[model samples]
Target: MPVSPLLVVTRLLRCLSIGLLLPCVPTGALAQQLASPRDTSFTVHSAYVKAKKQHPDISIARPPVPRGVRAQTKLTYCTPGSRALQLDVFYPKAKRRQQFPAVLLIHGGGWRSGDRSQHVPLAQQLAGRGFVAVTAEYRLSTEAPYPAAVQDLKAAIRWMRANARTYAIDTTRVAVWGFSAGGQLAALIGSTNGNSLFEAGSCHRPHSSAVQAIVDVDGILAFLHPESGEGNDSKSTSAATYWFGSNKLTRPDLWQQASALSYVGAGTPPMLFINSGVDRMHAGRDDMMRQLTALGIYTEVHSFPEAPHPFPLFNPWFQPTLEYTVNFLNKVFPRR
Candidate 1:
């Protein structure tokens, strides 16, 4: 028997609803649409809010150790309060007597959540590539705000330098790489090397917090820029507001002070920026790049097409991101 016209139309509609009729639509298109970088900052903020509601005591599991890498956990880097700030260090088994370069890996969580354990895989990957990798925990906005996180990161750098010999790290070749909010701190540390204001109080005194190179992965460069999408309006509370405890209207000076752009100058370290092409979170990136170029500082930028802000944390993009990072570090801090 011949099929009725109405029945044929209904079958087509059902196939279309399930996407079976749309052969041209790429596989994983829905996931790509959901993970688009266009509004990733807000997406991340929402996730944090939801996680806080659902699981107040959420714990991050440490990643499994990779082959030929050594893991050291919970080493105290600073004692800011009753709580001690600790870091996890990873390094490769030395093939020879040569010292390895070091990298301080910073995790991203909108400056409110997340911990050092989030970066364990990246740290292990770097360690496997013959670098001493340290992932350090910093105070979140929930505990302390604004410069507290920055100071803690700088302290980590100093602490690492002070104990460089113990890990067989080449002191002169130290670098920092931060993801998301950590990217902002990494840029801040690189820009404010000689500035005493950001130097955390006496954690590892007399040791320089200067880094020879910096790698920023989807980090905001200027928090107040119009393109930042941070809503600078008086009543609007941005992630920056949460970090600073005040809106731009109320604390314009502090907003400007905390910006990485504010610290850019002649001596800024060579930097490599890995960005998400569709991500607007790292607004004003071009402006900073121009300034770096004009000042004759070495800088490079690589954007992943249609990827999310945290693309580097996952596979397919992860390998390429790691390659770009290692290559940039090698070029900036070449083995002598």
Candidate 2:
């Protein structure tokens, strides 16, 4: 039986979505594509359009940056060789000499797409509320795999501390907030604080990447947990497969190592899990929270009953999400 050309193109498109452009891809086109960075197809506007289909009235417009807050965009945080990772800082206009607690925001796009701007609204809101909020860009899986994104984020934290005085950031009260894939990174960052394995090649070694708290917005704790939908590569390559550069079966070690549940301990920082209605997205959350609770560490969970996975970027849910985050941060890092 002869396969249709349309079927072949459709198959190739699926692979490209996850950064796998090979096998059926043309030799010349493959070489050209590999020479450049993969496309970041995810964006706040695109997400809003998709979410609006289900909830038509939801507004994507974030409240304007308040008068008390200011923004500094495109500031370089890390320069690994020629590649420069940039971050945007949104902070309260300091009236006195006082420093404010900081939060580093990481955006999510299944590890391959999306950029820092997706979370700018949240960062701005946090800044208006007396926190120095930063939205950071990391090397996506399309550009660099697994540890690269983690390394970029840890570097961003180090950047926060390195420039604490300039930004009026209280380094001692730093926290990380990430959505979806970024959420996974945030949890892993908190869980693996001071772990030497992920510290290689990271700059600002003098400034620690340890975060006092973590806010995971619908991120999975374990990639191989029973509730996880990751690592399934039966048809095209899955996001986990692309990020890890291998399937769960072939790279179980990476899967386990990357799981936040694998590193929970006495020193683990306080964590807040904000989840949507997706059960698979909450994989290992209960077990991880249980472990944290057993160790006497602070852990909390909040769910939006039937909200979308990207609810934090939409209306009705977005306001509540901001409130939950502000409340959590206020509780953990209260003013002196």
Candidate 3:
């Protein structure tokens, strides 16, 4: 073998050349990376930009905002003893207008990890359509506990109101919006509607977190902690247990009580819920919507026939969502 060193080196060089000529990554693995959040956003942004270029009405060059529009990242509220509270605010450009209506967006991550920044594209999309969109971050269960997130939401609402003039927002017309876990909280805010008991026991000053309307996209409505019931979903996690430490099966009374459906009485806000018509996600959207409807509340339901769970903010119907949201604002916002 020592006598064939030159031949062995020649063979190794040939193998190295062949390897370099092959693709850097396997085909499937590279595709998954492209679909990841980072790549997906870049792709979607390019698409949005190209589409806007083709149709300029959808976008306008407004300074004071980012390259596309006016956005400010600031701490809206923070945990009592921790430096945790923050929010991203997106609004129209200077030449646009003053005191526009706002949408407060909360993200979903099983109440353990999602942040408002993930929804920046949606915020920008909303801002592009003349709405002041805010994506807020609240304490998660690991960092805090139940009502901590709710309290943060309430604080955000109050902050929006108290600093309305400064932020150029019209507090009279605010909407709470969320996807999945966030959707549940949005429903809770809509259902509870200024309840004093829910607002108590938080370091945050007691303030109303209620909204004129609520849009919950695939959110669980009940807190069925220790979740049980012959019909309860076994394949998925329940909002009651994840956010509150129990499920409906073990806490039947509490489940029925905390379920957003239970609180839909007279004077509840108009609500829009979009979900697939099954357990793919949003386990009991139908039941919640039905219960709310029975209470004489204005409810609109749109189920994507075959869409998968948690449709990204880049789906085709994204524009339709925008249209419907704007319509809701037109009917609810206050006059100058």
Candidate 4:
């Protein structure tokens, strides 16, 4: 039987589609060959300064209290532009300067948009339960790309530590939590041990930007990936290029360097990844759990039957998701 060339081309396209869809952060240190200087060049404040011109009302919308949650907000960081860069801390108030476990939460906005206010309710709810909650804004790709977002985050970690006393923060037990694009950024901060994505910094900080635990919701596991049947549309792969200064096709190895899973190790923190239904875009959710479990790292993954992306934050406004997140927090920080 002669095989048609047409069939071969069609099959190739299908495989490419699958490749885009199933982007499991390459579970190996394939890009560690270049001993890039331990740096934080990727962190910058100019973009946020430019973005401040278009700021949206500077107010956070909070969810109504269910039972045992208290909320307060305070400015935590500022960019040179004082616009796109800022952070908000939410938590239960202490008598004076008492410390509590903290969760650094990042908001999702395709890497080029979004702000701390978008995540206010989540921050407040977490803080209400005796956990210090932080929502931070970072420079995005339109003005700064790749390491800029991650660098700002690493700076936030450092800032959190430096001011832990004033904020009543438990610097030793902090974790990072994020959704969608923010999730990828959070994981990137966790991975590479705070390696700068670009050559912008020469003098480095002595302390680390590592989080003790991670919670990523519907994040991109790989950079070149665009999900099955999805084009390099603005909603998906374009964000990769905008942030990293290149696309997956042009910079495959760079993509690997940007993923959290590739940096997993014995010292890497435990994880909790949540996925809504098995959309082709998020198939790697299982692969991540599988890899982390194989490494003896404590992990938990959940699938909300029939749910779609963003339910954990914006749906019916989180009934069980709230319970599930708080329960997970309790399990992780029972003493705090």
Candidate 5:
């Protein structure tokens, strides 16, 4: 019997897999060859740029609900305009009768784009882990500006508390988790609990906006830091400028006032800071951590070396990121 050409090729591939008649390269050497310094640099630069432009589109379909979880979509939390500001709620169907800790998940788009749907997968995962997780929508820079997004987030927290019994959520055990610009809002919400300046919304006003814990995923801590890579140049229309409606030179006070670090004090909640080690977007994270430490607040910081800014949203990094987040929340807002 004669072998077909396809069979011969398959046999060659099998042999190659076993290192037969092939040069055996060291793992380190092979990695080096596949990713030279120059190539790696370019790849990193490209990834950063791509991540910057990536935002959750309203049209993307939501992921299938996990087997043990139930999702409630588009529940109004606030009404700022013609459209109601809504949130998608996720909770374990099996544990729906029992009270659970709640987490508010905020999506990131430099406060210019992105919607609540971006965090549906995360909310679903948290629900599967026995949490009443909510992914919320807020006014963007396109609709409003600066404090408006923060106001919406704070209002969402208050809404959670206002409807705690309805959602089977433990009012005392709640946290806020956000990515990129959303992270900045989460951090600010965590720090400015009783502060009136940022708490401008009318929804759920009687209820407190405080969170028991905070999870900041690569959010800007201090906008003024040199390492921020968000230059202070007044002429450029950076995201910060767009969000603030002015440059640092023109609105230095607003820039400082908007920073999460500026509000960190005795009442600041425990925080977990996760970052791509190389991202300048999280430039002032260390400073914020130090301030929190000095104030005797519990703080944890984790960085994934050589990862991109949007690392947590994708796989490989997402698994570990989820693990870190769940573990931190479990410790901070433990179920009794």
Candidate 6:
């Protein structure tokens, strides 16, 4: 019996997400090896079903889109030659004359899986609450590696600013929100506001990629910090190792550079950290808060004790997570 290339890639992604490492494959060669039908198994529904094993009462059902909020899906935000990155937007239908603060939401699946639709419910709720919320898609580790996803996000931000009128977005109060791996990305992107290393492509180059605020949900701040649990590739390849294209020991420089804590300093914007009971999930958060506090940059944190890492997508903690996020965003980007 012969194995299908798509099945092989899907299994590889699942292994990587679970911290099992595989041999490094060159990007060009891997691109040529893969066939049609990309894997899309990771989603809020799947996560909820798995989480229900521990929390039997949790729910994944999202509320109805509130009245006056509009949703537009499958909007192309960027074209990186090989692929078209799409995003889903949710914003108020009325009050086109007034520009509202916007937030770009990024989902997480160990950087190997997950897609924009995982955060669509949250975006819809945010829109109902008077925000221009967007859920964006980026190249996963299976498709591309580090800096590629980051670049895609920065491009998405620029796209928002470039089409501010179409979405009724207030460019000055734009924010980036991420869950898990996405949270790590949000922090890094926010920390490196004008740094050119992560900023690439010419899409909406005139519009800045800098975000006014960052919301990190259970995402690590430092990859190689003493408190960090990532890059344990002694026996198996960790997801971080696969995404970075090198183990922490082999490429310490890249790991450190990718850490948000490395660049968080004077210019970093205000931030909010939402976490589950898993301390290892948010490595270096305390150190980051201390630095932000010293710099007089507003910082807030909320932890769901004993909750799973994907608490935001499940009930019992979902409402509170949404509340904290809304409060933090409103406080940082006050409504005019």
Assess the local accuracy of residue 166 in candidate 6 as a C-alpha lDDT between 0 and 100: 90
List clashing residue pairs in candidate 5. none
> What lDDT would each prediction earn against the true structure?
0.77, 0.86, 0.63, 0.62, 0.77, 0.87
TM-score winner among the candidates? 6
lDDT tens digits, residues 1-336, model 2?
A: 445557767876776555454333433434344443665677888888888888888888588877778888999988876679899999997766799999999999999999889988888889888999999999876666778889888999998999998889988999999999999999998889999878756578899999999999999999988899998777877888878866677668888999999999999999999999988987999999999999999989999978878899988888888888999998999896
Would you list the rank order by TM-score, best first? 6, 2, 5, 1, 4, 3
Best by lDDT: 6
Give the per-residue lDDT of model 4 (tens digit) for 1-336.
Answer: 444557645654564455442231111232132222322322213323332344422222246743544553555454534333567776666776577888888877667765666667777777777788888877766555566777777777776777677668877778888877787776666655545552233212555566777777767665544453212654555656546655566556767777776676776677777766646535355566677788897788766755545555544425555566677766776663
Cand. 4 Cα-lDDT: 0.62
| Per-model TM values vs. the true structure | 0.79, 0.89, 0.70, 0.72, 0.79, 0.90
Q: Which portions of model 3 show Cα errors greater than 4 Å?
A: 1-68, 94-97, 200-207, 223-240, 287-296, 334-336
Candidate 6: which pairs clash? Answer: 21-237
Relative to the unseen true structure, what is the C-alpha lDDT of residue 304 in candidate 3, on a scale of 0 to 100? 66
Indicate the residue-level lDDT of 142 in model 5: 57
lDDT for 206 in candidate 4 is 50
* Residue-level lDDT tens digits of model 1 in 17-114: 44232232222433233222322342334544554553454322234566889988999999886559999999987756679999999988878776
